[model samples]
Target: MIKTLLFDFGDVFINLDKAATFRELKKLGLEDFSSGMMEQNQLYEMGKISSEEFVNFYISKIPESNSKKLIIAWNSILLDFPQHRLEFLQQLKEENKYQLILLSNTNDLHISWIKENVSFFTEFKSCFDAFYLSHEINFRKPNADIYEFVLEKHQLQPNEVLFIDDTQENTEAAKSLGIHTWNIDPNTEDVVDLFSTKSELF
Candidate 1:
């Protein structure tokens, strides 16, 4: 029986424009996303570096761009959080049917933006039994260690967990460990129809 539900935050719960960051950076004259920049991002997501350092890294690259401009560009990917999804999550929490957990590969700047913009961020977070952010946990998705960390931390059997993510790479990694997965396409699907869509699992 699936007793635990592991969910990805972006694109699964909150809407995100995965391309918005690249586009925004281009506008800032960063025509190419260099390997160094990518490495810095992963480091930031893993909490290996502080937010000030992360912002400074970009600032050093584009000396004309200040911290505020870089932060706004970095946070351009986040979009609106739909009310219906929050309602759906609340109902699921009230039912107490599954041990809901949220796992996301996020950094400080993005989360800071969300906390400031999303009015019900706290309420939505309260629905989860555990909330694991990449920066806090020192791990990110598509990495086997991260998945193992969650399973071991919760003392959960891989077979008893249903991992839902918008990224195929993430879902596939979880599946390799015997967890059930749903690679949700946010454009065509709404998490509110979980029961109707994944009825067999329920």
Candidate 2:
């Protein structure tokens, strides 16, 4: 039986324009995102580097871009957190049907923007029994270590955990560890439909 639920923050809850950041960077003259740049992003997401260093890495690449502009461009992917999702999450929390845990691959800047812009962020956070952010935890999704960390930390059996994420790779990785997974398509799937869509699990 599924005794615990793990959720991804972006796309699953807060809406994101996955292409916005790339488009925004292109406007700032970043025509190509090099492998080095990608590595830096992963490092930043893992909290292996400071925010100052992250911004500086961009500034060093695009000398004309300032910290403020870089930050704005980086946060372009983030969008509003819909109220309906928040309500659904709150209802689940109140039901106390499962151990609700939030596992998100997020960085400091993105989270800071959400905290500043999403008015219900704190209330949404309160719905989860444990919240793990990639940067804060020094680990990220699609990585087995992070999944192992969550299972070990919560003392949960992998078979008893249900993980829901928008990314197929993430869900697949979790499934490999014996966890039940929902590789949801954010464009069509609404988390509120959990009961009807995955009724068998519940």
Candidate 3:
């Protein structure tokens, strides 16, 4: 029986333009993501570096861009959080049938933007029994250690937890650890239809 519902944040609850960052960077004269920049991004996401350091890294590469411009470009990926999705999650929380947990691979900058833009951010977070953000936890998805951390922390049997993420690689990683997963397609599928879409699990 599935006792826990593990969810991803971006492309799952909130809408994200995955390519928006690169497109916005192009406008800032950043032709493409360099190997160093990508490495720095991973470090930033894992909370190894501060936001100021993150912005400085970008500024070092793109001398013409200021901190404000870099921040805007970096945060362009975040879009909207549909009200229907929040309602669905809130209703699910009220049902109290399963333990709802949010596990997201996100950086501080992106989260800050969401807090500012998404009016119901706190309510959305309150729906989760436990919330784990990558930067806060210093662990990222698609890594066995991160999965192990969550499983160990909750004393949850992998078989009894269903991990839902938009990325196939992330879901695949969880599956390797014997966790159930749904590699949701944000384009055609909405999380609000979870029960109808994956009814057998429930």
Candidate 1 per-residue lDDT over residues 1-202, each given as its tens digit = 8899999999988999999998988888787889999999999999999999999899888878888888898999999999999999999999999999999999998998999999999999999999999999999989999999999999999989999899999999999999999999999998888878888987
Candidate 1 lDDT trough over 10 residues, lowest sum:
190-199
In model 2, what is the error at residue 76, expressed in angstroms?
A: 0.5
Q: What C-alpha root-mean-square deviation, in Å, does candidate 3 show against the real structure? A: 0.6
Error (Å) of candidate 1 at residue 157 is: 1.0
Candidate 3 runs further than 4 Å off: none
Task: Identify the runs in model 1 with alpha carbons over 4 angstroms from their true place.
Answer: none
**Each model's lDDT:** 0.93, 0.95, 0.95
Q: Order of all candidates by lDDT, from best down to worst?
A: 3, 2, 1
Instruction: Tell me how candidate 2 scores on lDDT.
Output: 0.95
Error of 2 at 52 (Å): 0.7
Candidate 2 C-alpha RMSD relative to the actual structure: 0.6
The residue pairs that clash in candidate 3, if any, are none
